[model samples]
Target: MGRGIVKVWYDPEGDFLEVLFEKKEGYFRETSDDRVMEKVDMQGHVIGFSVLGTRNLAKMPLEVALS
Candidate 1:
C-alpha cells in the first residue's frame, strides 16, 4: 500500500460523503453495500469511495473493503 494526501468531502444536505486517495480520473462503482460506492482509476485500482446516508452512521461504524 502507498500513502499520500487524502481528500474528503461531505454534503450535509445530501447526506453523502466522498473520499479520494488520489487526484486522478476515475469513476464510482457499486460495492456490496448499496450505500457505498468505490472509485477506481482507469486501470481499475481503487482510488476512493463514497458513502450515502452518512448522518445515519452516527449510530454505528461504517466499514467497507476497498479493492
Candidate 2:
C-alpha cells in the first residue's frame, strides 16, 4: 500500500490534539475513553486520532491502540 502524508494539528485554545496519518475521506468516532477519539476511512483503516486534553496528558496514563 502507498504511504500517505502525516499531519499533526493542535488547537491551543481548544486544548485539542489531532494526529492524522492520512488526509482522506474519513470520519471521527469516539474511542473507549471520553478524552480520545479516532478517525477511520471507508475501508475501516484508521487515518487519525484526537485527544481532548493535551495539557493533562503528563498526569495520566497514555496509551494509543486501535484494536
Query: What TM-scores do the predictions have?
Result: 0.87, 0.85
Per-residue lDDT, model 1, residue 21, is 91
Task: Give the per-residue lDDT of model 2 (tens digit) for 1-67.
Answer: 2376678899999999998888789888878888888999988889889999889988986786764
Assess the local accuracy of residue 14 in candidate 1 as a C-alpha lDDT between 0 and 100: 95
Using lDDT as the measure, which candidate wins?
1
Mark the regions of model 2 whose C-alpha exceeds 4 Å error after superposition. 1-4
lDDT per residue for candidate 1 within 1-67, as digits (tens), equals 2477899999999999998998889899999888899999999999999999987787866777887
What local lDDT does model 2 show for residue 25?
93
lDDT against the true structure, each candidate = 0.89, 0.85
